[model samples]
Target: MKQLFILFLFTSLFTSAQTLETIFIDNFEDGNAYNWESEIGWEVINDNGNYVFQGTGHRWAVSPTQRNSNIVITGKFKIITNVFHLNLLENSGRYFFGIHEGGVYFNNDETQIEDVQKEISLNEWHDFEVFTRNDSLAFSIDNENIISYKNNTGTNINAKLAFECLDDAQIQIDDLIIKREQIVYNQDAKWVKTGGPLGGIGYDVRVDPNDANIIYVTDNWAGIHKSYDGGRTWLQKINGIYSRTGSTNDAIPMFCLTIDPNNSNIIWAGTFGMRGVYRSTYKAELWEFRGNGIPNVENLTFRSFTIEPGNSDVVYLGCEWTLFEDEVPEGANGASRGKIYKTIYGGLNWIEVLDADALVRTIIVDPNNTNIVYAATGIFDRDHIAGSGVFKSTDGGENWIQINNGIKNLTVGDIEMHPSNSNILLAATGRLIGFSREPDSENGEILRTENGGETWNEVPVTFPSPDADDWTLFTYLEWDESDSNIVYCGASDRGFYKSTDGGRSFQPTTYNAPFINAGHIISIATHKEKPNWVIANSYGGGVFVSENGTFSWSDASRGYTG
Candidate 1:
């Protein structure tokens, strides 16, 4: 059942970096273990002639083979000291490489700190390597030249290569390999497609601060798309943003897109029931409605809104209705009418400033005090304690303050500043312990304040969190218009994070949580003239672009494909 093609020129089986794209090669003579998680007890032994893996003590072995890579697992083992350790996870922390009775060791995902030991061991069946990409990580035992290390810890690597055995270690693994190194983009590749009225769920992407290829992208079910060519090719404007409100209808769901940092064609559109917001004086090309003129826009659900990085016609609208279970509207528990709206002359006119009870998500003004704003709070479905933290406004939006002192699990999922120290603030929280929506057990944190929110600190997330399953929900946080210590966080589900030390520590980034949803990441943008050209928006994974900032990322939706 084998045909020899002969011209395999292959060779690169681990001289450190010359891979040839082979995702897996488990040579256990096929005796079993095919599904691979070996279930904490590993066996499959044949001993000397090979087909190995005999375990004892705290045993375990896994490899579901997650994605993003430059990978290299290479195997053949017989250990002692730390005996046999091997962990993997890129972009969400923890990427260890081990063998220790007190010698040959490694640690990355930037400082989970096994600290890269070295005692050298090669007493018999040797050979072991562990390679990574984008910020290096190399570890070997009987070949590929022993230890060499480096770690950025996050560029979105994918991991699931376990094999534990903590204490009395005497393992014997054999001939395994997992390779990944193949990326060939560029057939005019800027992700080019702009093709259809495609699938749906692309959250928000605006790009066109005067045309870096004129993009627009917004779709819950395909509401607006207009690419003057950056995303290759597409057009589905939705004639004024679709609706039949009285008959049959389709396109009109769009989540978020605010544009107009001084008129990039003056945009704004956040619809998803109650059409509460829409206006595009030509850039997303033609769409009007404007939130039914906000007479306290009812039953609500406009999701996100913010403008006024110094008056983009002064905007701020974050609406969402219904709070606390039984669909309370029967008395408006904790009342927050219209959730918070204020459109000074751009969406015509409207005002309802602080209806604060949570569900705001992001609204950081203060690029030098446009009245100093900040509105982060969240709680996707009403109960995780209704809605949580962060709401400061030194008078601009009039009045508000719940600063969330020294923050810790307060739902608030996004807020940034430090494009040059706007008093240095960064909040991208996580919480939902009760009535879970799945942060498994409140996993999310990156809170810092240099006196802005008056004091807060948590910033140390290489992301390998799961003492029991903290699901990692840091929605979005950006810093790097050009790099203020390079911070970036986006994980509605688990797939983006990188901090060069401004927020103290962070590393799991390479943005690919199974391409979105498995990694959620609601929204993120960069490129205030190409800050390495980044952009991410995915609740359902559409629209991802990282010219370089996150190292490499693509799929800027190419027209929301069908």
Candidate 2:
């Protein structure tokens, strides 16, 4: 079924002013339909030096494209036989014109609106144009207005243009020109949860680099949800995903997800239930176990995951083991218990590269230099005997060294590399949980390193301190791709914070943004092209969206039951 209704999210560039821009043009002169969704029975053919689209046989329809604003479509159309219809379709209603032997008739869906007895010859091309602006529409043929109507319904824009032939009618279309007018909408548009995986904690959100409409979100207990329509709806893709208990019926607790930059279809996922790592070559439709080389997969829970930008096959996996009360293994003190695995052959096999006493929380590979890698460690379990800080591996995880000279808090939850600079980086310190009792369990601070971890400094954050012994960990950190100075920090208990001065200072948003207050923010996502859009996933509150950056937020968890 065609999705007629969709949430049209316009960029901020179009919200302030009106501008006319040519959006689409298809002459079929390039011998390709480009974005036109031509049906099976439709084919581009050349007739006397003119290239045009024609219906080969049987009932067929072709949709050129769709727009979210007012559009003016001009094209040439010719009918070979039978009946044909030109449709401007939307969820609210449909404005279509039917050309039959009787006459040219206009209808708002099934209800006929107008009819004219003008004869249109078969196999004779005629200039046709469709203009839809505000609540008025006009259809012109041969530069003469044939049907003019004012739509009472509030569906003047956001419609798709399609050509259909009925009763084996043959048709030919060519020289299509589509133009869209920038729409000025209300700035008070609020976010609403479309529909997707719910009931479990959404840990990671990834948008396809090649196509923004395709989205992937990992849930702690829902395996993975794939959205092909910009997240309006989702489907659970867990064909080969399962929990550690070997129950395929139950959704696996997916902790992390990463898509190969070179190939969006190749996906890598990590589990929190000792399931190791899994890979999907065909997007997230299916999964296969790819944790062959790592030792003791049943005891470790995986979280941090990253792929080298230089080489997609070169990947890193971070795993950690939980330590219970007084259940630490003998001789485990001062010894690394958590493991970091490296796979150069795309997860076909893995090798234990580094083992740390602290849980490996995050891994970052330098885009400028893939050989240089950084792994941030922190422990959430009972034992905090080993030092938890950032580790640097300059030779592609072959060897490792600690680089926590100036960082006061070592439990780094997330690290973000500057988009245009490699040395400039930011890390968010997290808190420790479990049975172990520590006087200062609350750790919520932003640390910056401009010299590639050689020296680190703290970025002052003004968030109110949590109660004594209560943990308030900074769970994630993300920088606006369009502006590196705009950084966002997500906390486990302190809500959200933003920094506009390149991490020099941070301001808390919970005081004014009540929708995200006290919510355990697990992940923050930002688009490089869309700086005004921000999405933050709360552990229990579901999702929150900020249209004008992180200034204000609204609850976007309508479909989410979690």
Candidate 3:
């Protein structure tokens, strides 16, 4: 009897190893029409594209219904060329490797992949392997180790695989394979860096002011990530957060992060989803809930937060609330809402200063007069009916006045003021999506006021007319402290420009500068201790640091996140 049982066990093991399920086999001899179904959800543009099944081109789509836990997904992908674009537009242009398990997709879609290993080649056949055992998952590409994921919730695992395309990219694919297997869990593998500028996605990077080495990054749907040595080593920080709640999505969207400039020990993170702002005081070792005075209305999200420069106890928050026609139920109470709040005593006391049915985009304090403040507001829906335009408050947060006399039909996005000259103000605005910029529109002016907010004039700098679609939607302007007349500005697609005569006339900086084509300078901070040192934040690209003004640049993103 013992001998018979041993033989049976051996047979079972061998059979299991040989008969791993084949998911989808695509030779791509014809076109993607036969083996794959092309479904474009929210892709901006779709052009037919070829994709290698294994070399960062293939993606999975888990069925919307399933309840299994342990799953094994393996395949063989043959790359036909050395270079190929992995277009993920079919799945909202977001996901790469999606696992639909127990009716829950890995990142809310079957298009999401936690990690990918870069090894498969275009001229050869390679093995692709993924295994989910217990509450963990592993991926191997071409027999090489790739990445491992720990499934804390032990959700069901049921998913399918497919290919994605974007911008008419092209490549060849063949010999696909898959299997179900059980394996030991491991957490020692590194993450394969993928996706970026290719998609409109951006990352929020947090730098420890005291130690620039410690950095935290959050991808669109990948959840919170941490890097101890700048961005060299990264780890997923999704312990308390769900990778995928409803669909097969595996991301935690985060917008703004603020580390107490005075105390690097304190950290604040504003995230979308059910959970709002998260606070960590012990250097992010642990986190606690801090969205006390904030609203919990549906779709209301916290976008940005600013700490009082002199007083860490004071904080301001900006939120975006909107009600889309599709978002409303058959019958609802009212349209969506948005508001901006100020907390004089940390988060203990909250006051709503700007309450509108629109989103509060940007807020800034005059460097010369801290009590003076400015805020830009815009409607959130397609109607674009009411916008608060630019608001000014001379007595801190006590009172506010509409400063839109010379501004008309403006939907403001960002606001900036000269460090030395509080009277010099710059604003970025846009027309309704489908409309064109009118000469009379107040949407594209680098407004200047030599005497506070009493009056304004169009800076002589002839900005690309609002009709220039290539210009950045949310443009940024900054005045050089070394020379007040020397100002620097950047747009999303229009590249970077410099003004030596205080926004009167502008010229492109040297092409060699890092600010060129950098896109929306998120924040520009001149090093107080180091006079000529200026740091500029790029949305998709990392940070660019210049020692000799904005003339030359270096990748300061060594410790920063993408």
Ordered from best to worst TM-score, the candidate numbers read 2, 3, 1
Residue 416 of model 1: what lDDT?
83
Better structure of 1 and 3 per TM-score? 3
State the lDDT at 57 in candidate 1: 76
Each candidate's TM vs. the true structure? 0.32, 0.60, 0.53
lDDT value for candidate 1? 0.64
Q: Tens digits of per-residue lDDT for model 3 on 1-562?
A: 5335433433442223233332233333222222134443211111244333322333222222222234454544434433332211222222234221111123324434443334344444556665544444555555554554543555433444444422323333444434344433445785655423322123345666555457665544444556675445556554323224225554466656667765778776676544356656666654444555666554666656767667777777777766667754333423334467887755644678777544666677665666887777652122232556777788776788878766544566566676666677766555334333233332344556666656666555544455553333435566665566777765444455677787776666631444444544555544333445555555555555666766777654442233
TM-score of 2: 0.60
Candidate with better TM-score, 2 vs 3? 2
Best by TM-score: 2
- Residue 197 deviation, candidate 1, in Å? 3.6
Model 2 ranges with Cα > 4 A deviation: 1-199, 244-249, 324-326, 329-336, 379-383, 432-436, 464-472, 511-518, 557-562
* lDDT of prediction 2: 0.71
Best model per lDDT: 2
lDDT tens digits, residue span 1-562, model 2: 1111111212222345676666555566534444456678777777797768887455445464544456788999888888788888786776789876556899987999898887788878899988776666667788766776666765455677887777678888898877778656667886765555333566777778777667777777656777676555667676545453435635467878888877888998988756557788789765656766665445577877788996888889987776653656554432224678888877766888998877887898999889899988873332445656899999999999999978876777788888888998898875644423444546556789999999988887775554521456677888876688889887775567888887888887741345344256777777766766677665655666677877677654444332
